[model samples]
Target: MTWLIFAFLNALFESLKDVFSKKGLRYCDEYLVSWALWFFADLVLLPSLFFMPIPELNARFWWALAIGGTLNSICAVLYIKAIKLSDLSITLPIVTFTPIFLFITSPLIVGEFPSAIDFVGVMAIVTGAYFLNLKQRSLGYLAPFRALMAEKGPRLMLVVAFLWSIAANFDKVGLENSSPLFWVISLFSFISVALFPLVVYKSRNFTGKLRRGWRSLALMGLAFAIAVSCQMQAVSMTLVVQAIAIKRTSVLMGVLWGALFFKEKGITERFLGASIMILGVVVMSLF
Candidate 1:
């Protein structure tokens, strides 16, 4: 498949993964569910080593893996925890904050400065995020921002966004020293291994939880594996922004699934808000 096709597939599978994860989270411990995402997916990815050549290790690759893998583990935990704690529509849309944070982080880390269009994109994203909670506008104009601050999930996701912004650059550094497929495999392996202690400590009945939610967890893991693989393939084939801009469409899918499957509240507004947020991301990418 071409990069565009893979990028679109990545978005579709990512949405499916999030929906399945939220479904599993309803019955399983969030920590265990988080572990299942990486653990089961790692199992699926392990056999691919026979088909692909192993990447040579370097200090840059190791440092990037250590930092990026640790942050990714933190993000995985926080992301699932947010799903457990808030409406899918609400929490998923908030992740759009990542690009917005990128506008700040990119210049500092990578020396990539934002353009005037970047400012406009940032404004558009902030506006969309505001409208996400427009259902609570009866309280005041600041209700949406207030809701973001008051909710534990949104607050945690906010931090997750910033961390991802930083980790993303390290991923590029890793890619500079290795192939994308190898990078994906190495990254996930490290994450699964690194998360072992925390997952075991935080989840008292991890095995039981995995058994209870095995089907959903398996589906979630399968989706994640495919999505991330496609993402890596897509990124390797084309501009990273092209792959990610398409992948961010997952936010819209999350909104749709939130309404149809989960029956979350305020679907219309959230969908509109997420669409706007995604559009802003597209603009950020194009500019």
Candidate 2:
């Protein structure tokens, strides 16, 4: 049950991160926003290492960090690019597909398999996400699928979701070998460093971009730090798929933010879709 609390908190903070990241992306390229995500998160999280007791690291921890960090660094760029290229409501909800992919990766990587009921809940969430684009159905029954294929953002986000499913299992392994905070700190550190060269290469007027967008980037970093910390804590306490299923509720909040902040349309259908996602989360959590 405590894991549920952390999971929900993860959802809240994760949504905040998405909103802030989307705002920051207005002034910075995906490369800079992607790098700043971990960089700023490291700024917020690194300080806590001094206050917390250092945990003993193992080979497994380092291995998971390296692999997961690489995958997530790639995912971060794709994710930011997705949001930059399309509506947040459209691209963000596509992440709900992660739980579906997790059904395969979790068992193979972490030896954890979700039950039938969990599958049902995952289906509901995925279905609800599909409904986020329900307006597309006006064109045809398969219009949503067609719309997804037509949009670069949703397509890239689909890749991010699949990669995340695989990376999350590594996250569980990393958590098993180290404390949650330590694992998050290490992972962020690795990703920030890995993306440094790309950020430098792809970004022009980097200092100016940072200077102009520092507030949003800083908020994005803080939100991301809290989100991942809560997420790792929840993951440490529950099955990876279950934990991630709960976190995917962020899509609901992302949709609302899209409506409120960005004035994106289709709110009626998206809200209905988000409501179904909430029901699915409840089923997964309580049953």
Candidate 3:
């Protein structure tokens, strides 16, 4: 129960982060903003390292963070690109199957075979994503599939989903095997953000935009840092698959915010799709 609560909170904050990030991305360069976010997230992580005595580091911890950070960087960049390329309604649902990627890959990566119920949940997620890609008025079941096949956002989102799945699968391994709660994240953030200066240094025309994006990116970093910490807390207390399934509710929240705040098109079908996705996640968590 406590883990569920933690997972719920994690989902909520992460949804908010997605909302704010999409808004901020409208005014910022994707790479520069992502870089700033990692930089500030590391800064937020630093103070937490002192909360308890630092423990001995292990190769697993470093490997987890390094690999997670690299993959996450790829996910972040692709996500922002998708946001720029498609309507929030379209792109978000496509990316929402990130957990599906995890579900499919978990067995391979963690060596745990999924139960029959897990397969059902994956099917539900696929159905939801399919509906989300269709036009609200089309009612044509194949329309979304046709649109996705011809579009770039779906392709980009697919790459993002795969990378995100890999990162998420390693999250638990990194958290438990790590020396300190915040140190590994801090290191990952530092290494990842170190690439931002290079990004900014390379772009002359986007300097003003980059400066403007810095503050929002920093805030995103803080939110993400907190989100990751909360996720770790949940994973430590509950089953990793259950925690991840619950966290997928963020898709519902993000789609809602996209419709209400961003005024994106195709709200009706997206809402239905989001609800189905949430239902699938809930079912996955329950049985």
Candidate 4:
């Protein structure tokens, strides 16, 4: 029960953080935003490292964090690029399909075969998501299909989803031998700190954009750090796959935010889709 609450709170914060991030991107360069976000998260993680035991550091832990951190940076870069190139509506739904990839990968990678009902839930989410993306064109409701075919956003999102699932699964493996939240966060922080010098040296225009994007980037980094910490902690305490399924509930929350705050219209189908996906989440949570 406690884990459930933690998961939900993590999801909620993540959803809000994404909203703020999208808004921040309006005036910022994607690369700069990415760098800033990572930098600040590392800053937050630095102090925690001082308190952790030196003996706790092991080759397995370092390797896991190194690999996972590298992959996650790639994930962040792809996501930022996608957001810059396409509509949020398109990118989010496609990425929200992580469960589909995870569902398939979990059994193969970790040897955890999901139940038949879980597969049904996966289908329900995909169908609902697709339906929600539907738009009315001259051909009538072929909008989503046309948009997906025309835009790189959806494709990039699919790729991001696949990478995130792989990274997430490996994260579970890595966390097994690691110390508490501090070291986990510290490792992530180290990864980010290592990247900053390169980011600045490679991109001269980054600073100009940072002037405008810093706050947004920092907020995203902080929120993301907290969300990630909560999730990593939650996974440590429970099942990583189930933790992922619950976290993906952000899709439903994103839909509501889009409808209410962004005033994005023509999304009745998305609401229905989110509702169905939410149902699957509930079932997955319960059984």
Candidate 5:
């Protein structure tokens, strides 16, 4: 039950990180924001390594880090780009598709297959996505799905979701080979370093942008660190599925943030749709 608290906290802070990233993206390029996320998070996370005993490394750990870190670095950039290019309500809800993708990637990467009940969850996700753009249904029955495909942000986020499914399997492998804290620290550090070269290559005034947006970037990183820490702690205490289902609550929080912070329209539909999607994830994860 205590794990529930940490899981909920993970959801809250994860949403906050999205809010901050969206806000930061207003002034900063996606590259800078993406790099800043991992870099500053590492700044907050790396210090803790000194306070805890280091876990023994293994070939499996290194393999997971290499694969997951590279995939996540690309996902991070694409995620920020999605947010920058579209509304949070539109882009964030699409992330819920990750679980559906996990049904594919997990079996291939980790040799784990979901039960028959998970099919119902898949249908629910598809249905919920339809409702997300219910306002567009006047155009046609398939309009909502078409809208999702037409929107670059949602399309890119779908890619992020798919890549995340693969990375998540590696994350499990990495955590199995090392402590959660060490894995988080190592993965984040690896991503930060991986993205640094691209951030420099893509941005003309990287230092100036960082100097200007340091506060927002730092806060976003802190939120991300807290979110990941709470998630890892919760996972340590509970089933991975349970922790992840609880964490998907961030999708709902993201929709609310969209309405509140950005004053994005279609709140009633998006919120309802996100709620349904979250219920689908919970169903898949729990039963």
Candidate 6:
């Protein structure tokens, strides 16, 4: 399959993962869900290790994994926290900004530069996000920005977006130094280990939460593994921006999922912003 096709698959699976995470978050603590995500994903994917050869490691590769894994732990926890606090449609669309930040970060971290056209795309994405807060524009034209700041979920997701911008470059570096499958497993393992202490402190009965909600949490983990694996493979075959730009389409899918599954309101508004953002992402990645 083509690299873009893998990217589309990554989008599909990522949306599904968000939906699953939201479902599990209904009864499970965000930290438990976060920990279970890496735990079960690494667990299910462990079997594939036997078939894939371990790539030779270097100091640079280890550094990338450590830094990326640390940032990933932060994003993972905040991601679940975002979903827990707001509607999936409302929060997920903000993640499209990762590509916008990637334009700047990739140049510095990975030596990839963007053209003027890509800057326009970034503006389109910003405008799209503005549309998401039209409901609160009663105060002023700029109330959307204020509204986003007021809403903790959107705010947290935006932080996650910025962190992901940094992580994307590290991901490209990691893939360059290691195979996709190997990188996924290794990175997940490192994050899982690094996050253990935080998870323990976040939940007094973390193991009990896992035991009680194993089935739902396992499903969440499964979807996460599939999405990440597909994304890594897509990135290996193309630029990180290209893969992530396509993957941000998951925000659109999240809008639909929120409407269909959760019967969440504001679908039209979210869709307007999400569709435009996805368009901007496409323009940014391809041009």
Model 1, 23-77: lDDT tens digits are: 9986688888888899888888889899988878899889988888998989989
Mind giving the per-residue lDDT tens digits that candidate 6 earns over 29-145? Answer: 998888788988999888999998888999889999999999999999999999899899889988888878887798888898888898889888999998887787788999988
Candidate 3 local lDDT, 70-142, one digit each (tens) = 7777776778777667666666666656656776778888775666786787788778777776672284767
Name the top TM-score candidate.
5
Ranking by TM-score: 5, 1, 6, 2, 3, 4
Relative to the true structure, how large is the alpha-carbon lDDT of every model? 0.86, 0.87, 0.72, 0.70, 0.93, 0.87
Q: Score candidate 6 by TM-score against the native.
A: 0.93
For 216-235, candidate 2 gives per-residue lDDT tens digits of 99999999989988987898
All candidates: CA RMSD (Å): 1.5, 2.5, 2.9, 3.1, 1.0, 1.9
Residue 127 shift from truth in candidate 4, angstroms? 0.7
TM-score-best of 1 and 3: 1
Task: List runs of model 3 lying over 4 Å from the truth.
Answer: 1-5, 136-140, 183-187, 205-207, 236-239
Better of 1 and 5 by TM-score: 5
Clashes of 6: 0
Candidate 1, residue 140: the lDDT equals: 92
Residue pair clashes in candidate 1: none
Query: In candidate 5, what are the lDDT values of residues 156-235, reduced to their tens digit?
Result: 99999999999999999998999889999999999999999999999889899888888889999999999999998898
Q: Give residue 156's lDDT in candidate 1 (0 to 100).
A: 83
Clashes per model (N, Cα, C within 3 A): 0, 0, 0, 2, 0, 0
Global local distance difference test of model 2: 0.87
lDDT of 4 by residue, 1-287 (tens): 67777787778777776676777677775666666666777677667667766546578777767777887877776787776676555557666567678787788877877777777777776666656556634455667566565778668877898988887766766766765565567556765765677667766677777787777778887887787777766777787656766887777777677777677666677667666766665555456
TM agreement with the true structure for every prediction: 0.95, 0.90, 0.85, 0.83, 0.98, 0.93
* Candidate 6 lDDT: 0.87
